[model samples]
Target chain A: MSAQTVADKVDRTDRLGIQQPRLPRLAPLGIAAGAAVLAVLIGVLGGLGSRIQWGLIAAILFVVGLYVISTVVEGGRQAKDRLATSLVWVAFLLAVVPLASLIWETVSKGIKVTDGYFLTHSMSGVVNVAPGGGVYHALMGTIEQVLIATVIATPIGLLTAVYLVEYGRGALAKAVTFFVDVMTGIPSIVAGLFVLSLWIMILDFGYSGFAGALALAILMMPVVVRSTEEMLKLVPNELREASYALGVPKWKTILKVVLPTSIGGITTGVMLAVARITGETAPVLLLVFGSPAINNNPFDGGQASLPLYIYQQWGAGTSASFDRAWAAALVLIVFVMILNLLARGIARWKAPKTGH
Target chain B: MAKRIDISGLTAYYGDFKAIEDISMAVEPRSVTAFIGPSGCGKSTFLRTINRMHEVIPGARVEGKVMLDDENLYGTGVDPVSVRRVVGMVFQRPNPFPTMSVYENVAAGLKLNGRYKKSELDDVVEKSLRGANLWNEVKDRLNRPGSGLSGGQQQRLCIARAIAVEPQVLLMDEPCSALDPISTLAIEDLIGDLKTRFTIVIVTHNMQQAARVSDRTAFFNLSAVGEPGRLIELDDTDKIFSNPSVQATEDYVSGRFG
Candidate 1:
């Protein structure tokens, strides 16, 4: 449009080439190979105790390599930022690799004995070293116990959170808050021991799934309270005042306004708490007594949960029992994964329709 | 139906610190009274006291009498819940229930009372939204979330929510302070129409908004920083704006000082 040739315009193709020297696309691959070689060499020379030590050294080397490479090519400031970014990525990978490998190992070993027969059949009369046993009783027991625990814990936890956030005042509220925080840090085994002493020793009750659930509920209540309290606190005070100003009573306002506003977060929290207690082995071991046969009634007979099944199978110390153990671990992982997926789904579905 | 509010010897405190002290005034039924003042003057706190909402805050207590027609709001046997049922409040920020639909927001207060049929609920929801002048714009999309509306429309929805319960007095605290000029004008017009059916008291930082909407004006002031705020004067909006009695009122009205 200006009626001038392209060469007549001021151009900086050469200057642009020399201005900034970016790291090559293949630089990361090179860094990975270098770190790996360096890790193995140092690990062997120092006689590291575990292979995990090699990974730690490699992670450190990658970060340092990124920082030094960036400093030489880019600048000091950019090198620091790149160093931080690489460190974070290394941290992310550090967390993910263990989790991924765990799942990978479970899947690979689990598929050998994991099938529809494995899902539906039980280990009622099978020998410990035999390979024909299944986890049907354990699955049923896990579902029932978790359901009972959720039912018992949700309302009590929710009401306590409501009190803490909505009407909490004075030293009493402070004491409750402090106790809840302390309860959160109590070990799962301690909760199991408490229920065992109170119910079996004091009341003279026999082992049952109901007794196990009581202990699971104890472990779960503090989690539910802490999470629900946070969620309820997130509801804006204006919504409550709006309902209050409209002449709605306090209880009605809480039911209609405060709870609904934060219901999505509350449900997610509850489900997470459910998932947490679903895999609890210590409580089930001390209370459930780990039955191999199928028992439908949770309040009467001994129960077999997935966590307890895995522990029993692993303790047998045989190759056949090892397969069952890995398969049971796989099933437990899948159970927790499904609960997490369902929780997220409910959260997205029931979340307040606020966005455009 | 609107009712007159007479407040006397009203003093409020947050723990040991006095927020407002010795404020006395009477608001006539079916009229708009505006409280005009600077920041930290306790105009918002005074409005909260009328509905017993100030006590909702921790350590917030009041020494006063708020008489609505024949009943003492702060009497020993009176329930704060019942008092709130008779006196509704709209806050400064537009806060429609984020989880509720536009129709559900209007129906929320009525549903709490729990005796209305579905048809009756529809009628009240339509009537209240109509009363708030938001019926036509939202009638087609009643099931949409209340928060999806524009700022002015959400405020009107909150107004609709307040009026759905058929309260006697409606209190507003700086209702238009967070709005744009056009939205502010819209809220001002809605306030004017709302005064015909409900006694309204508004707190505003903008003097012009007070002048435009209110029939009477009350000026609140503090003697100095960190001191309890007090009512300087209450008079007709024209007299208060055109010629205030106190020199500090004149200075504040004329933008001389905060």
Candidate 2:
């Protein structure tokens, strides 16, 4: 029925609307034909001079020809839609061109020095030469420091979230929420400097991986707390009521029913927050004094991480160091990508099955 | 087999604001009583007070004597939890735990308070579902999520959940308001049958429902301008609907004041 109506309307428009028309589609078609003929003539002329620029000129004429034909064959609505669509495609192409170019340039330039030695060796001895360079120590340092940070941050973050969601009542909860909000927007370098001053200047302890972890903890705690708080809030009040109506105590309700219901979302949020802080470089640089060889202890001395390794190698300016830096960057990106995929997978798996 | 409830001089408050004042009533054993009133007239509040569900709302307080089998529920050292265990409630919205299956939803109250053997749980689940008149339709799909059922089934599931712990006094707050006419008739019939075993008190806005399902009816109305709720009459349902004592009850039943 719809198709028949549309066909009848089309017939009516063609028969009745075109009866009083001359060049109903003529002016736009004429202009389009004229431009195409001109583009062909230009191509013929350019064939004698140079054929390369002819491709570029023909592309431009084709676009201009489309604009002319559209304006004539259709009314303002169709013409405007065509114009907007063309412009959108052009804008998309413009964006893709630069992004693709940057990615291509990074991969091509950065892959030259990336090798197995880049993974296994380190910048411990010798000089800034093209032959002796790697990020093995830096990679070890990064992993140990981030693991230490996770240890320091996870309990505090989860506890704070539990308190806020389960027991928080009035002014105290508001105060904690306000502070967490402020902490989320804190500058990374400032957090590093703050932790550095508190431990090194006040307590008079030298730089260690623990200090770097502390700074990263400052950055990570607020994120974990906020995300976990949101996940906890997503748990339905009916679950709490159901538990309470069963004569379960308040603490038990929160622990058994509420936490179990929101566990999936909480895990995803925590992992995402971990991915966020694992790549931090500024605080690590300020608190961790890097070494060429791996130091597993986080509390005693300076350590290196993947971000720090990339920064050091990129700043060193030796060809081999530059290659190691690119390799470290590639590794970090790969780690983040894996974390993202894991987060998505966990979210999908944990989402409650609605129908049984 | 359960005992009766004797409520005297019951008054409810939200913070400092009095909601229902100087109300008193009794629910006999193995009988059904109904509270009927307009919206915000505090019929539901009075119902919640009997089961101590009123305390769930912060700042909600009550001053009253609710004696169930010679024990004063409002007395000091009385755990509201214990009171609620004996006096179960079904809410206006049929809130079966959405995350639980049909069997789990019925078993929630029993499992949460303490541990029960699997054999005991199976017995309780079957009995409760049978008592709510829902066993025949849902017995085969006991593992299905409670939320997947139709609205009427969900309400029956909630009813089954409430009765699973074998509470003596069942307080239903507009249990049939969210149901269809067919479902409402089924619930009304269930209420009539349930009165032979459990003492039941229900709050309902539907006058016809009060007339259809209740043995006794309590008529509630606002006392004065800007004042709290007051009970106008409590009598047999037939007398209350046919020829009430108070002019207020008559006017209300005849759609004058309300």
Residue-level lDDT of model 2, residues A181-229, one tens digit each, is 9999998899999998999989999899999989998898999899999
Give the alpha carbon lDDT tens digit for every residue of A154-218 in model 1. Answer: 99999999999998988999999999999999899999999999999999998999999999998
Interface residue Cα RMSD of candidate 2 after superposition? 2.2
For each candidate, what's the DockQ?
Answer: 0.69, 0.38
| Candidate lDDT (C-alpha), each | 0.91, 0.82
In model 2, the runs with Cα more than 4 Å from the true position are A1-140, A200-206, B223-226
Question: What are the per-residue Cα lDDT tens digits for candidate 2 across B47-95?
Answer: 9898787877778999989999899999999998888878888878777
TM-scores of all candidate predictions against the true structure: 0.93, 0.79
**Distance from true location, Cα of A57 in model 2, Å:** 19
Kindly list the per-residue Cα lDDT of model 1 for residues B42-137, writing each as its tens digit: 999999999999988889999989999988899999988788878989899999999889999999888886857887899999999999989999
